[model samples]
Target chain A: SQTIHQWPATLVQPVGSPLSLECTVEGTSNPNLYWYRQAAGRGLQLLFYSVGIGQISSEVPQNLSASRPQDRQFILSSKKLLLSDSGFYLCAWSPTGGEQYFGPGTRLTVT
Target chain B: AQTVTQSQPEMSVQEAETVTLSCTYDTSESDYYLFWYKQPPSRQMILVIRQEAYKQQNATENRFSVNFQKAAKSFSLKISDSQLGDAAMYFCAYTERSQGNLIFGKGTKLSVKP
Candidate 1:
């Protein structure tokens, strides 16, 4: 079975600091990757999505950016973080025309 | 752009009873997909059910099923014999046929009482 993994299950970063979050899929090649954020009491917000390597689409424009360095590896980074950047980050994967599978998620707190 | 709406911010049901969570969407395209996702206190997002706009028959998985009214653009989820485990924040999502993006609603928090 295919699985998704996310690093730093929980993170605490100071304001104006840099940010780097990684997501990887195992047992699946060329899968669609997505980055979503859930605020304290809100729904999932699609931040970015990638259909293939080196291809990325931004759903919402902000301080965050996403990159697909490899076929199954996606990275979310920021040169400087903002206080509003704090939220629960979820990484998901799906096959073309298929339902998405979510990773364990990373709770990022930007103080 | 496709949009999903879940009017109920919170709902509660007695254990072993049935509960229906309402979800409606708006889209100009005829070909699309609707989904219901469950997010537990653990914060993991899980797919509860999905309905294709082309399929007239509602999709069902075990105790979960959908009431898809394509013409009305309404897709509601029904959970039979609701259990404590069923308590969670349920979100309604939509994705157009040609798009890879899944748009989500604000979500409804469901609580099960024993």
Candidate 2:
């Protein structure tokens, strides 16, 4: 069985500070990875997705960026964080046309 | 661009009763997929059920089932004998045949009462 893991289940960052969230998949190779952000009481917003290593697609333009450094490792980063950047970040993975599996998610609070 | 819509923002159901959550989507692709995901209070997104657009018959998983109408572009979820554990924010999602990215609706919060 494949599983997705995300680091820093909860994070608190100061405004204007940098941000980094990591997600990796185990038991699967060359899987599609995605980063989604959900604001308080809002829906899931696709931030970025990667089909393969070094192939990243940004769904919405914002203060965040995503990178696929490895086949199953995806990282979300920001040079400077904004108050609006606070939200619950979820990492998901899926095979070709298969069901998507979500990670536990990281609750980021930018104060 | 494909879009998923869940018009009902919230819904309630009495325990042991049936409740249906509505979802509709717009797409031009002939081959695609639709899914219902449950985000419980724990905040973990779990796939409740999935249906392929090509398949005419609805998909069922235990107490959960879908009424997938391809022509109507409607895919509604029916939870039979709902339980307290069924309370969660249900989201309708769509994935194109070519793209692995799944588009999600705003979600409908389902509250189950005793």
Candidate 3:
């Protein structure tokens, strides 16, 4: 069975501060990884997706960026946080073009 | 470009009854996939059901099923014997066969009353 992990479960960052959120999947290799954001009372919006290491496809243009440093390790980062950057971040993984499985997610608040 | 639409912002159902949440999508591709995901109060997205465009038969899980109308571009989720645990925000998503990325709808908040 494959499982996905993300941390910190919750985060609070001040404006202009750096941001880093980590996601790692165990029991799978060369999986497709994705980053999605959900604002309060809204649906999810895809931010970025990676089919392989060092290959990322961005969907939304914003302050955030994503990187797949390893086969199963993906990171979402930002040099400076904005108030609009606050939202719930979710990490998901799929087998090639298969259905996606989600991580526990991280609640980020930028004050 | 593919787009998913879930017009219902909220719905209510009685426990042990049935409720249907509507979803429609637009896509130029013939082979694709449609999915229904549930986000509980905990906000974890859980896959409820999925339908493949090539298949004509409706996909069904234990208590969840889908009405897939390829021509109509309508895919609706039906929950039978609804339980309190079924209360959640349901989302409709679409993806192409060659694309791993998904396009999601606004979602419908389902409330179950006992």
TM-score for each predicted model, relative to the true structure: 0.98, 0.98, 0.99
Model 1: lDDT of residue A67: 96
iRMS for model 3?
Answer: 0.9
Instruction: Provide the TM-score of the second chain in candidate 3.
Output: 0.98
| Residue-level lDDT tens digits of model 3 in A38-74 | 9999999999999999999999899999999899999
For each candidate, report its DockQ versus the true two-chain complex. Answer: 0.72, 0.74, 0.79
Of 1 and 3, which scores higher on lDDT?
Answer: 3
Please, what is the whole-model Cα lDDT of each candidate in the order they appear? 0.94, 0.94, 0.95
Residue A16 accuracy (lDDT) in model 1: 97
- In the predicted model 1, the residue pairs found to clash are none
What class would a CAPRI assessor give candidate 2's docking?
A: medium
Query: Candidate 1, after superposition: displacement of residue B3 in Å?
Result: 1.2
Worst 10 contiguous positions by lDDT, candidate 1 chain B: B94-103
Q: What TM-score would you give candidate 1 relative to the actual structure? A: 0.98
After superposition, the stretches of candidate 2 with alpha carbons farther than 4 Å from their true spots are none
TM-score of 2: 0.98
